[model samples]
Target chain A: MENRFEKQEEEKQDWGAYVKPPQTSRPSQESEASAQSSGEQLQRFEPRSETSSALCDIVREHLHALVENDGAIRPEQAAAMFAHLTICRDCAREFDELNRIVSVLNSMPLSPLPHDYSGLIMLRIEREMGGLYPLMDIPPNLATSSWTGEAAQQTSQSATQLNNRSLAGILSQTALPLWSRVVMLGAFFATLLLFLTSAWGRATLDATLSTVQDWLHQIAQATAEIPLLGAITAEAFNALSQSVHLLEETYLHIGANAMRGVFLDTAIAMGVYFIYQGRQKAKRAG
Target chain B: MRTVTLVEQSDAELVRHTLCGDKSAYNTLVLRYQRQVYNLAYRMLGNAEDSGDLVQDTFIRAYGALASFRQDASFLTWLYKIASNLCIDQLRSRKTRSALSLDSEREEGREPANENRCNAPEDMAVRGAVQEVVHHAIQNLPERYRQVVVMRHLQDMSVEEIATALDLPTGTVKTHLFRAREMLRGRLRPALEMEADGK
Candidate 1:
């Protein structure tokens, strides 16, 4: 096997030429598999014509950082690279160059700031923010931390209270004009209505419902291993599936498309909801 | 002592203070991380002025979105994410505006201005802001590869941290870093030869 691999490797000129060696090398996969199954050690041959060079590529990647910092490559791959380096003068030279490159990269100086931009940053923040937040004052002294514990508590209470504002207040924070949002919302609803009322929309809704039902059933099955939780999950999934089936039945009577609109609408809605939730979470944490 | 306590407050605490309507807390956060963020930006954008501007933009954006930050996560990692995205966006915009100055930089062997003078007597030309040569080599790489290289090698960010910053799976991050270094090895061969000569 080893002799054959070496012979194949020697014959290949370009890297691309050695792709289909296994067919030529092996008598048949069934004979090989059956031979292995008969309690024989079959050497678990890889097409070494490729992997010998492939190992070169893999190990070269591993040698990107000489020491494998942060576990750059798996231990086995690293060991392989180290072994290859000792035998292959070319890989060793490449490794040396790689090591020098990394060392040089590490030796680079922390770029000096032209000046301490902290003062300029604070001043810019103050000047630009003067009119934006009438309620939230720019800290009195940008250079000093004058915010006492008591002030933090009181201000935080106000901040928490701030989260309770109406949806309009949330909408106001966004740069989108009210008119555009209204148009978008209206268009969304219209499209949703058209999907639900149309035949193609009905088909889409039915397909989507069935897919969701399958997912819920699988989840229900997974939960069944947990005893009490599984029973509850099974029941919940049954109800959900029944509801989806009922919707599908209703869609058959009326109209709807493939699952396309559902995906498009759900994706858009999920994007908007996640963005809103992220902001809310950030606000609460902040 | 009180000042030290404020200065040393955990990022989460500072974030909480900022959310509580204390602008000072946000400023404190900025002061703590500005230099670090600036360093990352400089590495990514390959220019001092833009990196400086990105530092400010990162802080301001972080400040605006402070309420959205998860306290459990490292604030610096989160800041790096913000700075990294801004840097990539700037890099993309710049890519369309003009060709990278790599060829010109190579011809000039332009060194970084105002960078600390190389103290290591062994082959300063190969090791020093002769950094500009390397930086330009880095600049010449595709943005995705450029980002991972800067984050991993230059910023000293762990692979996991880079994975998080770039929203990539760890395996993919490793591949990019490896391939990026492989691409870089050939570009940086001259420096290694220069080092060999100095030896």
Candidate 2:
């Protein structure tokens, strides 16, 4: 036995070379009292099988109920069972021991990790997948753009407008939920159509457009003095300006009929969003 | 728009992102549950090397099968299912190879591993002896009993969760748990006595 223990102690020492040290705790001290009292409040859960009963074990019949941890036993039965344990010293000793084991197991501190496995696991995953997956989709940035690439100079005003919309679309999708986007965009176009139907609506559109244009210019100019940001902000402002110009021209070309289509599309989107809302609510309720 | 940090995303959201080919989202998931998985494997397999290997395999297997994961069900329990199956396979394979440890192959009527070592409470009251004894005692339990006890008691998995993970009925899981504790009672009785001695 001493040799066996010596071997185990050696093994534990070797294990400590990689694994963190085990915590110092006495299992007996953990949950001694609450086991019996909690047992009294629990509902009785008699096991269907007594197959585990050894020959000569008299309290084998009550063993399952006597040490029941789950609330399968009723309080009255538990109390009576506890009382019965007192009558049988052997059963009482078993109950006390079982309770100690439960408490100790319950309070057993989780074994600590030896080290962060993230870097190694991630390294293996990256090799397995053949590339590093970026933390999130890389946001559009002029800073990271290839200045030497032909695409930078070749990007036309229309291409920039498309790129601007693409960026906006990505950000909108990421930052806002579908319902919020639907509500905001649908309401904006619907309200715009409402305004366009009257004489003030065109002015309102112009005002909103100009306000947006001015805000872009202000941001562009304010950041222009900051050296590195000046180019990106100027490019962004130009894209927005072109987008606003395209919007006004499109409105003029399509006339009031296009506004009607906008209203119709907004109505459909709103309907779809509401139906989505209802389904989500039902799912959560279920 | 600010990018949502990996920490801010829910498990479901992470799963969705992973399915969408976001590798980092899966990493977030691995980092979140690796400790739990490693500990589960350690308790089940009884070694650090195998448990560490199992943790990596669990995550990799989970990622490979993420497409089939039912969004409505639990992510952690699903991982448990994978981990438990792997553990059983490893144990069975070990048994097949005749490499199963003597402690693991313990018969019900056999002498306790430390019976002679712990003849008296005073002899058993070494520092960390209770945990060490309990650990060995758990290692002695039959595989099925060990799985249920580790998942239900150690991992804090609900009965329903254990049933789902092990593909057993809740009633059967409860039976296994009770029998496990019953087995533990005899082996661990010494530790409790040592504790009662306040060592």
Tell me model 1's lDDT, rounded to 2 decimals: 0.61
Superposed model 2: Cα runs more than 4 Å off: A1-69, A129-286, B1-3, B99-124
lDDT tens digits by residue: candidate 2, A23-57:
22111123546444434333243222342123115
Using Cα atoms, each model's DockQ against the true complex is 0.18, 0.19
- As for model 2, its CA RMSD to the true structure in angstroms is 17.2
lDDT of 2 by residue, B25-117 (tens): 788998899899988999999999999999988887787677667867989999999999999899888877864354454545455455454
RMSD (Å) per prediction: 21.7, 17.2
* lDDT of each residue in A1-286, candidate 1, tens digit only: 3322242333333323222212222222233244234222213332245656766665565565544355544444444444445444445556556656777777777776665767666667667653233122222121134445854554444443443354433443454546656656655644654454445765777746556667657766877788745787577666655666665566565534444556477668757965885686467435
Candidate 2, DockQ score (0 to 1): 0.19
How many angstroms is residue A53 displaced in model 2 relative to the true structure, after the best TM-score fit? 15
lDDT of 1 at A258: 44
